[model samples]
Every structure is written in C-alpha cells, then in structure tokens.
Target: MKYPILCCISLLGSLTAFTSSATTCPEILSSKQRLLNSTENIELCEAFQGKTLLVVNTASQCGYTSQFEELEELYQTYKDKGFTVIGFPSNDFRQDRGSEEQSAKVCYLDYGVTFPMMARSSLTGSSANPVFTQIQSQAGVKPKWNFYKFLINKQGKVVATFPSSTSPVSSTLKNAIEQQL
Candidate 1:
C-alpha cells in the first residue's frame, strides 16, 4: 500500500510540473535557454510568458558595447508596462572574452542592466543557440554584428528586427515597442 501511494505522489508531481510548463510558454517560442551569470537553464514560457521582449545579441568589448546603458534604460522605462530586454552575450564576433562572471560584471556593475541576460552563446550561423535559430527562422533575418535586436510581441512572435545601428532610444524602435505594449 505504501509503495502504491509513493508512486501516485510521484506521478502527481510530474503532472503538475508538466501542466505548468505547458501553460507558461506560447507555442510559437522555443522555451529553453541557459541563464546568464549562472548554471541554470530556464523555460522562457515559465519566466516570461505574455511579455513583450527585446531580444539582443550582446558583446562586452565591441564598439556597440555601450548600448547596454540604453538597453537598460529601455528595460527600466517599460518593464512595468510588460516589456523586458533579454541580453545574450555572444563571442561569435570575437568581441567578448572572459569568464561569465567577468561578462556579467560588465552588464550588471558597469552598465546597470536589470533585465534577464543569458549565458554566452552563438547568435549566428548553424551553431547558433536554439532560441536564436527559432528567431531567425521566423523573422527571416540574422545578426550581422553585435547588438542586433529582435522585438517579440506578447504572443511570442517576432514583430521586428532592428539592426546593430538602431539605438534603443530610436523613435522607430520605441514606436515598435509601444505598439506591442
């Protein structure tokens, strides 16, 4: 009888986890990503379902690296309005080199980034991370350089792709973001 009860408990726990995960992410978005500054992997649906996102490929040592400040400004400005900016530190362009800790310090300590940032991962080519692959597949664009941004709507669809030169404060980007909000 005790064995049967234990099995039932295990099954119930599994079902609960499955149900929550299923409801957390929209079907259009790939839900898996490794969090920055840590060893944990996350399901995006679980963490950011129904939110507008500015997904950016970032580098710590690039000419565009200072965009982190504007990105953080955007994040702070619209976070309460269901907007978030997720940064992915990528070394595909050979701009960022250091431990994850060092990279994170640049984002958190130097730039004051408060939004979620993922671990270092490729953002272009065949070896790109799954999330980037999905974004590129749907959006029909790829990052030509660091700080390329994709704006995703609340329904998890890519609404626009902003090139590296587009400032976070650009009225065009801001208008696109405001529309989603």
Candidate 2:
C-alpha cells in the first residue's frame, strides 16, 4: 500500500543524524542564508537535520494570530517527536507589526512563541527569501497566503501544504506530522 507522504519518516526523540547532523549554514547559504530565531542567518535545510519543520509565514495582525495557541500546543506535543515549528514573521501581506522588533516581540509576549522565530521576512513570489524559495523549489509547493504552513519531513521534502485557514491544531496537519513521526 502507498503510505502517506510523511510516512517515510517516523516520530522519534532526536533529529535524524544520518542525513543532516553535520550540515552547516554556510553550506546551505551558498544558496541562501535563512534568517533564524531573530538574528542568525541560518542554513534551514540543515539546521533541523532529521527533524520535521513546520514553516509558517506569520503576521501579527492577521485573524489567525489565535492559532499561536494551537501552534505552541503542537510544538509541546511533538518536539520530542522529532518535530519543530519555525516561525518566520512576515509583513509581505502588510499585516504584521511593521518592524522586526515589534513582530518578534508580539510573537513572544502575546503568542508565547517559544519556537525559533526569524526577523520579519517575505513569504513568496518574486521577493521570496532564500528559505522560502528553497522550500518551494525543493518541496515543489508555493505559499498561498500569510499563514500558509509547509509540513516538511525529515529529508527536507515538503510533505503537505496546509492553507492559511487551516488551524495549526487541525487533524489534517496533525496527521501529517504524526505520519512523519
């Protein structure tokens, strides 16, 4: 039988070492350095190593800001399951707090975002940052809106696309993460 796109990887305690443990940001950045956790320009393709990365283009003013609660829930639930949620604050939709510090602060204070959050960045189309563009090129998917979620499996492949309206706690998203785990 055909397995789900995420079934190729299983839930586990740590990131997969075999495929990505030693990878460096410089290496990935030969292509593009992804802004990581407020300041560092990271090599996203390698940083998570064998982990499933839930990449979302976030906006503070968007209606879906409430999804932050569920996002934290999912992170708490699966972080030990070898998954991570990467929040990339974006004003590409003109919905964010308008500054890197403001956006980052909002995510931390209001949403209780403990996950890695990049400084505000663009999500898609022409101005796509390296991380966003790389994922689309590698995963063969594109962002649909401000809150689009890209469920990437251990191998850095985009397993599924959860549209902006899909709650972070939705079963459809959870199922994909579970399958990867």
Q: Top model by TM-score, which number?
A: 1
Model 2, position 131, has a per-residue lDDT of 69
**TM-score of each candidate structure, all chains considered together:** 0.84, 0.77
Cα lDDT tens digits, model 2, 84-169, are 99887787777885566677666788878887776666767787766687777776776767778988777667778888999889
1-181 in candidate 1: lDDT tens per residue? 9999999999999999998867757654556778888989887776778899999999999999999999999999999999999999999889989888989999999998889999999876777887788887888888999999999999888999999999999999999999999
For model 1, the stretches where C-alpha displacement exceeds 4 angstroms are 1-24
Clashes of each: 1, 3
Query: Which segments of candidate 2 are over 4 A away from where they belong?
Result: 1-38
- Residue 74 error for model 1, in Å? 0.3
Residue pairs whose backbone atoms clash in candidate 1: 25-45
Global CA lDDT of candidate 2, please? Answer: 0.74
